[model samples]
Target chain A: ATERPEALLLVMPTDHAIPDVDAFRAAVAAGVPRAVAGQIVTFGVRPDRPETGYGWIEVRGAPVDGVAQRVERFVEKPELARAEAMLAEGRYLWNAGIFLVSAKTLVAAVTAHAPDLIEPVGEAVAEARGDLDFLRLSEGPWSGVRDISIDFAVMEKAANIEVIPLGTAWSDLGDWNAVWRENGGGIVTQGAVTAIDCEGSLLRSEVGGQHVVGIGLQDLVVVAMPDAVLVADRARSQDVKTAVAQLKAKAVRQAEVFPRDHRPWGWFETLALADRFQVKRIVVKPGAALSLQSHVHRAEHWIVVSGTAQVTVGEDVKLLTENQSVYVPLGAVHRLANPGKVPVVLIEVQTGAYLGEDDIIRYEDIYARGDEQGPKR
Target chain B: ATERPEALLLVMPTDHAIPDVDAFRAAVAAGVPRAVAGQIVTFGVRPDRPETGYGWIEVRGAPVDGVAQRVERFVEKPELARAEAMLAEGRYLWNAGIFLVSAKTLVAAVTAHAPDLIEPVGEAVAEARGDLDFLRLSEGPWSGVRDISIDFAVMEKAANIEVIPLGTAWSDLGDWNAVWRENGGGIVTQGAVTAIDCEGSLLRSEVGGQHVVGIGLQDLVVVAMPDAVLVADRARSQDVKTAVAQLKAKAVRQAEVFPRDHRPWGWFETLALADRFQVKRIVVKPGAALSLQSHVHRAEHWIVVSGTAQVTVGEDVKLLTENQSVYVPLGAVHRLANPGKVPVVLIEVQTGAYLGEDDIIRYEDIYARGDEQGPKR
Candidate 1:
């Protein structure tokens, strides 16, 4: 078989388990050159427990040559003692859900091992199209392909697979506890926390959450998101998916999603809200402009607290400096900008009947937000 | 034989206890007048501890036919158990080291009790002088009174003695922890604190005179003063005196003093320091001016980051606004003022052989500080 010039690197992030980025980058680079030598190099992440949530791979034989070996068998999640024994012996590597192989090599190995995965994937890539920064696979073959992981279709049965043991710092940041561990002091932990006789515990505070004071605690993680809070042991953080699903089932917005997200323009956050009123702080970057939009149900008031703001309201255009305020009635077209070389800080208060973000109708946008159906106000 | 219409209120504060003014005011209004009943009223404060570091009160009964009780005994500190018993007994109140008694009552009681304290204190107050709103007691009698508390000569000897319990918030500001608690958040706890699983533990975070990060903490009472930190139990905050004595015997500032104090006009604080450089944030209120002073060992750079400032360097006078900076060479007469209505914030960076608060040689005075015995820088 002829080897293709390009290689395919398939990566599967198993929840956020890596604790350091430098180690992960080093591990990824360690096997890159070997995979380029026509050998299938795979990183087998050893399972920390007999976790049924993740698929597993079993090593069946020794190295094929200098770079690769054949897989004897692949298993779903195994029982506890079996997993322990597999770890005791030196031959098994947990399915890392990651693969690195030349395109020709992967196709050839899968063909000899599990040919079902190749046809649809090949057909989809052959008809692939480009859209902006992403490659769009053809719908017919892409959707027709069975929803299966590479571990189940190829690595478990392939005859030329090799495992590379990686001791690296990595994390998927999949849950709140993992996020809290990595971001303890970077964000706000307000009001007061008393930690005594504890280590490796991550605690976060929200603006109006309960006054949390940890005393004689160890390795505990506490997070105060918007309306919901989480307190868990770090080792049990993987169960956060179950927690998030429960929250979704109960219709808790705070547990399912974050209230604020950064955007290219700047940032907007709702400080407080009621049925008839909503308050928001909008920070626009220097020389950035917002969309020319109008709210069907709301009247708005903009107060400038710092820097300078350029405002376009209906037919009038004005330059508002610090302490100055402006008003826009319902259905009035308006837009805001930072004309100078400094950030424009402004507070926006809206009064409306149905104060939902979807009430906004954008006439024009500078950040191409019109294409994506974003929440509006 | 005759019942006089006077008594003295003696309050003795413990180690570094800063009294809370509002709470004391509330307590006095609610408890004092009725207890006084237009007769002599005195407060007897029990000293929490004693090792000769603070003045002590010797108590005895006053002699009278119908109204006076004879003082049979007097003694200094008797040890820890004695102090604890004094606190537990219903008859004793903490010697808060403060008093509120009519002039007539104190004079008569002192004459009948110690008989020696009356003349000196009377003569001193009679010849009392005033300077810049402070009552300067005459050195002759004021200094001659042996610096004894009123408890020894007045409260203990009186036949009819009554104590209006001060249940209000009172802090003597005995140390940095007291200051931090009185000035900031309202939570306190103790033990070997590991600020995991929590937020806001006002800990004594100074380690060998270095401040450490209380991760996952907020609104904490951290008392990292000059050289030590006493991470005490918040609820058992009354025990701070024990910690202070422990630090004071070791000659550490963290237990004894704060890094900064507020003057009537403004405030100054040491922000950071190195072996060769030091930084301070100085504030001057509206119409307030710093003394015209010069340093022999260090030059200073002043940056005006907020409000407006009138800066004097040698013979030159200039107005500095936000973002403007000035330089003062060593031995140059320098003064700063807030010419505007708002407070002026100035940052001072010093570089020289020595940078201490006592390095100043004042040529002019604004707050009468030029004549006072200055600190050792």
Candidate 2:
């Protein structure tokens, strides 16, 4: 917390911002001592354009030695000429998503300007809970506050906000173009990508997925996420939020999320699709068991491909190994357990007229999934 | 072939010389009556430019009754201004790939001027060997013949080389740009592409093999092949032959061909890589088996993920079902057979200090891979 006559690093993080860990570390190592002199240290990013996409900072007057003059005022992205002027004069920064401060000075400064943030943040820190190396802020206070960025509530009103021009490469990774810029362009392919005439774009496919191909495209973003695919122009990538909003508005099952949700127990994914039938690849961790339940509308066929599967079907219990299979009729009380010490992988083919999450009638659940179950998270 | 009115077709391939198929077809279709009565038929193409890329025909004298013209002389693509003057004069026609003529008239003209081609072509056809669906021409006398296009070898020398300009949309498909134009400019990825200052461009990506992402590029042709990738300027695409020659010179595996070699059985692909180890996903068709072989430097591990695998390790044999595994030590002869009526899918992990195709020693074979040891086509 002590300033050591090094530079003060200012980091401002936007919501959903994931700052480059390496750059933040580099900035800290470069500016620790200069911060002791009460000189300002802030990171300045080159504006991507006269971007209505970001908040703009205008540095007024000349530099006081190495420290920049006080910021005149914060302004949102301006008209075209002003943006061009900003690019020409080159003093303004794009308000990089991060900032670092001299512990003593920033606390003093924030207390003077925005007392509400400082007190709650201080209390939260004092009473902060730690679990698994993560600092969990008390949700009651952290989420209760008005949704406002530090730029709006604090930085704009500060008087001695000096600028540190970031000539080093930086990217917000706010969208696909940023991702493309991060990845050196040309021949960008993930999972067997075939592309032609694509420029300044990111084409990605997740693991265990089909190959993706892009042809004669330039400056576009193609993402193959589980359950949903996203194809958008790089310039219009910010509108993905609108896509997500539309998905929510439409109540689309695919857009809501992937059907095979990942958990600590291992994940399950569906492979076969039909109106009356579905097949799933089921994997369970060692000694894990599924809930004791039955599908009201569906019957299931289980093929034990590997490991040992202990099945309780109605009045009978049996252990199945590789090359063995079983069938569970609808409404029959059934539970699958991996009684062995090895991961169990199996295929379950389900037949039903209606296959939806709501059809699952859980009788008892060890993983806390039913109504009587506790919140698992 | 019978004579038909008002429907003349010509198939003029873009090559040095051959009798046009459409011309022959048109000749057959037009019969002797209509052609002699002056209902002329012909094929015409628009010139790209004063392109040395094609052969140009010039018409002299005036149009005779708006039906026929005296083809004074055939001038190949000339200097730019002269070609422009030819176009301006509006009395020239770029030879359409096809020419239509009445059978009687064409046979008579060929007999008068190109009698040599007629005899050999006639013998070649009479003695043509039947191979599958195609008529294979024997090389004996056919190869001895002079290589000349029917247009130059016959039409130019004929007394009645009528010119009827049929302005149907046509393309030679002689270049990448022409193919792209025919398929639509944005055929690869459509309007998803945005070119900024790029010109004279041809970009194409094969599905599931390559994806091109471009930035700050111009006049470039980028083709994504299955195994190898190509990036060349449009002007230099013609020089791709040079690149292929270099690759052949260097004996690079990808330069000459692709990695996915088709076979009688199912295919195999590399899945994992390490300096001393390489893993492959091998799929065997039902009733298919690998050759009995041994590797001096490499050992292999096979884990059956699907279907039944019949494994022969030295003198012993075993049937391994899904989720079962096996290990083959170095210098130990082993062969895998898929005797079940289902495809066998397995993950094979191989480890060796030096792993190359040349390391395998085959003893007994099933698919004739060891016979004569020809290149895997």
Candidate 3:
């Protein structure tokens, strides 16, 4: 279906940031000839510190082809003493999780080492369906495939795996500490953050009109979101998921969902929520139409603030430009659409005794979300 | 004025908190007889620590009447070693800032020691006027009185003075550290606050519906208000005034004012502010009426959420119950009042090109604020 290359294909995680792209390209190029000769190539970074957080790759002998060394084994994350001992020796390298191999070579190695995964994955891919522009894999076959990483299934068992040394500025931003290291290891701040006498800290505010301040803080991480805030030690940044899990156990909506809801058309955010009334700021993308819907418990008033909106209420249809407004009475079927070439922004004030989002009954939906009642746009 | 006591009058700063009221009363009672016998009395507490924040009172002679000692001198706040040495001497006590003296004795002492203050203070009191329930001092003579403490103007030069020891648990609460101590010396939190692995910190959130989380924090002070937030080291809590002064220099409104505006009737807070529209939640106490006013550049929509509202729009007057609404067009005279026995709560949505609070022209007001142009109720 596409221009398939014969020499090598490189795979790298999107999270790793390599500052020297030219040096990385040279390292990948050095492994291309060896990979084309049926040797599975994995890049390894020379250990600069005794970092126990990373896995290690041990090289057995000198480079067989002057650039790639024969990998002896891939070791799991080790203790401090073990990592220090490996760092004292010159043969250990941090596993960079980068692979360079031909398509045929990967298929052959998976067939030999992880024979159970290839058939189900291939069947799922062959039966994948296209939705708009995204390809969704078949659920049944994909769920049947074993969940395992390439290191556990292929690289650990393959006999001809080679290691290429990568000597460039790189970092895997796995936690707030790593992010601080990537950002020069002093004080990193963003968005309405004020710091005084702070050292080695990260303070971030993602809320629109809120502020975060830190004073005399050392080795701390403070993150402020709109609905929730997080403060943790730099060493405990990996335990942020525990806080999220705690919130989930309490059924806190802010744990997983943001105040702003993004959809295919555009986005909408709640401005205020009251007992019997609610306010929202909604933006509709150009040529996007909401579903024809009716609510038995609520009535809505929409005021256009930006582009024009095509509004249909009951039997009447009208175009509302900036500064114009329309009202939908309870039990009235209505549809809102943006027919212009720009986004339409409006403020919606809904009033009712029961104003939950599940009160809506959709008759037609363009984004195929009529049956799914999780959130309303 | 009706029941003047012949015994001593006790004066203490309102900010100081003494936990053992019984012991304090007993100490005051001990000084009453001495004070009635024509000696001015001052209380002193034995130093529990080498506290440099308070002035020291040095005693010279033993108890004259078995409970009070003759006073010697008052020393300014001392350096560390001086305070420690004074503590070790056992003759110096921390000034408790309490004074007790008979009215006639105080008059005689002031006449002899601070002759200049007696005349103007007497004239100001003689010419004071009664306004409603308050006695207002005459401005001219009151302003002429010198700004000097009683210790400097009278007590230092008085011949018959006595010092009494009073042992009790007390706190000045001069700064956040003192407040922390008053709260029992560990993490003290109020409102919606969550803490993890925090020690000796104070985290407070005064705003409703806002969460303040502190993790791995030690000796930190964090205060969150609706419109502003403050974070500072516990050691530098006394320097928080500098931050407020800096904000004042920048003309930040949050430095001196809160988001909620308190009125004589009740209070109101802004819910949302936009380019040409603003929303406010207003509460009115029973039997409270707003001014008859009109806006030049805005219109308002009032929706009653609780109780009843007596609304006057232009020439029409009506009583709106819960869930009822009314609209006031621009330049239309209007007034809102709570006529029921219960409080009234309403949401006001104002739409205009210029939505400043100063756009109102008041014709009549029951609160006698027609001539004053300030925040409107």
Candidate 4:
């Protein structure tokens, strides 16, 4: 409802690599006049290949000013031979999903073609709540809206649609191969990666102190994380989702979570896990506090390595600075807070017969997650 | 000298993979009698392929009792065509280097062919010093001896020679391919390894918590260690030594040393190393003690996690059990000893401007290595 221009630009999520920004901008400018005149203008790219992944736009005639043309029809992804025939016909363009329309025109089109979506979306937007800096939509109205794209809802059936063709180097970086291609081919390596006799491969190590060695590899992708690793053929990079699915089916925690747990206070990572003891490097953000909690089965030894920590153990409270340490006996209710302007980093060593995170009983939590256990912090 | 049988056996480093111990033992037993009769008998294996990697032993005649035969000569590794011809002729066997001879006969052979070696070797053995239970050879005479193998010094020119063909499954295990063959085929993996569409490959990870993933890899070798990794084609596995040589030329510590340093007392591994700080997990065997030492630039905090430690700090001596810790300030002489039957395991956190092992000066050491630094323990 704020004061602005009458028209709006809707950029749909069509994964693309647009190399010629000037040409793209010029093409969009050509459609701005038409859009302002109440026409919905969709930008398209000249089909260099018979791509089976993108939809096509058929123009009614050649562009009036060699920039924009009237739209004849919108077509779904076509078969390879039919796509080639359309390409030979020289009237089809690959849909890039870039749209420009007047706000009133878009509302009119949606009201005419898809009346069922407006009420729920409007209600969801009206009932949205402010969460910190994010606006959270009302779940009831949002979930009630039908799951459909704008193409099926209004764009395909709208009259007064115009099409503009853009010629530029574009690619959809949908997989590792696409990324490799975007990187200008050859071996793409990062971190502690050593590649010998490797071509058209991507080898990356995201974990510190981890090394990846690739030898005589062609068209392959290797990604090494701290807690998990992935190796996939370059052509089969899209199938990496299958690995995620398999890991999820197996109920592996690494499938959906990382070794370092992020929290409102800060972050902590388990350095080592053993049968009777566990070691973690905990970092608390400035002016952040942890829950007042106690563990029945564990005793903790905290060594402050950086900044300052205000620790409360039992009825005693003390501030520990760098190079100092404190011990918390078993069952002692303790809390750690960073009160300084810098982060407080400490090494926490927990020893017990049963050191499961479920052994904790939270008394108070500022983040309102007292019932959450096992790495909520 | 002690009174015993005169005959002796010498097992050269053949790098063999003998599958049938009974058959090998019987083959050696057959040669024992001939060796006792003063003939220098060398066991050979019948050629199964035209292997160009091993030397060939020519037999003078067929095995008298399907076991032992007179040896004609030993030939060096031949060209592929020559090896094929020899394999087809059926009179040659691979030189297994398994020798059985009477001690007096071996002495006579050495006297005849390598006269200069016997005197120096004998003097070196005679002047060997008894170090604990190990006999340390006198460096003076040992260094003066010629660097020649027994084959070139004696067996190649000996007057009395014999060969016993051993028809058993044996592999030299000279490379990864040989190891893969010995492992009975496709995708041999150890530790935490996941293979997807991999064939005829060897993937091994020696470090705990390390995982190796292979995808669509054919005839490749991947070995992951704590501090280094190696990946090579299976056919080029022998060239892994070349990689080691290159690493050595670059003066990489991982080329020759492992992350865990072993000592006479026990072992210790660096858990983490950072600027001006280091963490080590040290294990001390029962009845073992570290040298009384002091570091000019470092302070140490030792936390005993297992067993008991007898710690001496300056003038005070204290016994610390599990869950107890002690701090040694910089320049304070200290010693740690394991007095319990089990090993004393402790986490040592070192903090200093200079945390190098060379920063320490030892006052007293029961192992008699006071001047040694850098993990001599």
- Give the residue spans of candidate 2 off by over 4 A: A1-61, A64-69, A74-98, A102-153, A164-377, B1-175, B186-236, B246-253, B264-266, B271-274, B279-289, B303-309, B319-325, B337-347, B366-377
After superposition, the stretches of candidate 4 with alpha carbons farther than 4 Å from their true spots are A1-174, A353-359, A373-375, B1-19, B27-43, B53-56, B62-79, B95-167, B205-207, B273-279, B294-301, B313-316, B327-332, B349-359, B373-377
Clashes of 4: 1
> How high is the DockQ of candidate 1?
0.02
lDDT for each residue of candidate 3 in A1-377, tens digit (9 for 90 to 100): 12454647788987888888888988888998999898999988878899888889999853332279888988888999999999988888889889899878888889999999999998898888654445767777999999999999999999989998886767877777788778887899987677767888888877554556666777888777655566667887776667667667766566667778877678887666777777777899899888899999988877676789999999999999765677788899999999999999887777788877779889888876675546564
Q: Which ten residues in a row have the lowest lDDT in candidate 3 chain B?
A: B1-10
Model 4, position A17: C-alpha lDDT score: 82
> What are the per-residue Cα lDDT tens digits for candidate 2 across A113-227?
7777875676666666654235656655665566676676666776656565454556677777667766676546675344545576677765232334454556666665434
Error of 1 at A159 (Å): 9.4
Which run of 10 residues does model 3 chain A get worst, by summed lDDT? A1-10
- Compute each candidate's TM-score over C-alphas: 0.44, 0.49, 0.73, 0.76
Give the local distance difference test score of model 3. 0.79
Top model by lDDT, which number? 3
lDDT of each: 0.58, 0.60, 0.79, 0.78
Clashing pairs in 3: none
Model 1 stretches with alpha carbons more than 4 Å out: A1-9, A12-42, A46-56, A62-66, A71-83, A100-198, A203-216, A222-231, A242-251, A263-267, A270-289, A296-311, A317-327, A336-355, A365-374, B1-377
Q: Residue-wise lDDT of candidate 3 within B171-260, one digit each (tens)? A: 777777777778987989887677777899888877554566676778887777655566678887776676666666766565667678
Best by TM-score: 4
Please state every model's RMSD to the true fold in angstroms: 13.0, 11.2, 6.4, 5.8
Q: What is the iRMSD in Å for candidate 2?
A: 10.4
- What proportion of the real contacts between chains A and B does each prediction keep? 0.00, 0.00, 0.25, 0.22
Interface RMSD of the candidates, in order: 15.4, 10.4, 3.2, 2.7
Best by DockQ: 4
